[model samples]
Target: MDYKLIDNTEGKQYEYHIDGVIAKIEYIRAKDKIYLTHTEVPKELEGQGVASALVKDVLNDIEKKELTLIPMCPFVASYIKRHPDWKKLVLKGINIA
Candidate 1:
């Protein structure tokens, strides 16, 4: 399933608009790294892989922009734990676990 990921810079979040609801990952960027603070998926969209897809796309976007990630959100950390390949995007000194 392909979803368009929106980088709402003014809102400081990456969003996915689907079925009239938005699933988002709030972030804070400082210098070369981004702190993924929280993830939210509407109740209507839960258990539908919306959160996983959103996090995957957000990580991809971060990689493309050559920014390191710090998975401050538990959901994002767990996602990285499941997908070890994405761990490369995480900042060197940070541990997602």
Candidate 2:
């Protein structure tokens, strides 16, 4: 499966396309911190690890830019909770509540 991540500025989100279909969507912003919100992967794309790949790519971009992350998206928040290794990238004092 050929998947690619593209930022749709007009939509204020990053789209993950698998082949030609939008397999997943993630809202993002870069400022004092990188905030990720409302991530969703199509039902067909679920359990295929596409979401994980998308999140990793976004986090990699954040790391490359030396930006902290605010994972407002539940999926991202949960991902961070499960992956202690990624905690270092999170924005300090940002409540995940």
Candidate 3:
């Protein structure tokens, strides 16, 4: 399940286009952390791991950039819950919702 993830900086989001639909995770950076504001996967891309791939790629890039994550999106939060290893990327003392 390899995807060509694109960092559309001009759009301020990470995008992965599949099946003619775009899956994206929108974020806002504040200081050393990125607040994951939303994740959207087209209905056509559902159940194919597109959203999962998008989030994973974005999180990996954030880690590489030495920034932490503040996941406000439920999808990202649930992803972190299922993958506890990524919990390390979450900023401490911050309430994630």
lDDT of the candidates, in the order given? 0.95, 0.76, 0.87
lDDT of 1: 0.95
Better of 1 and 3 by lDDT: 1
- Mark the 10 consecutive residues where model 2 has the least summed lDDT: 19-28
lDDT of 2 at 79: 80
RMSD in Å for candidate 2, one decimal? 2.3
* Of candidates 2 and 1, the better by lDDT: 1
For candidate 1, the per-residue lDDT at 90 reads: 90
Candidate 2 Cα lDDT to native: 0.76
lDDT of 3 by residue, 16-62 (tens): 87777788998888888888989999887789888888888988988
Error of 3 at 36 (Å): 0.6
**lDDT of each residue in 1-97, candidate 2, tens digit only:** 4356677778877778775567444556667577787788778777988888888777776788787888888888888787767888998887554
Estimate candidate 3's alpha-carbon lDDT, on a 0 to 1 scale.
0.87
Return the TM-score for candidate 1, rounded to 2 decimals: 0.96
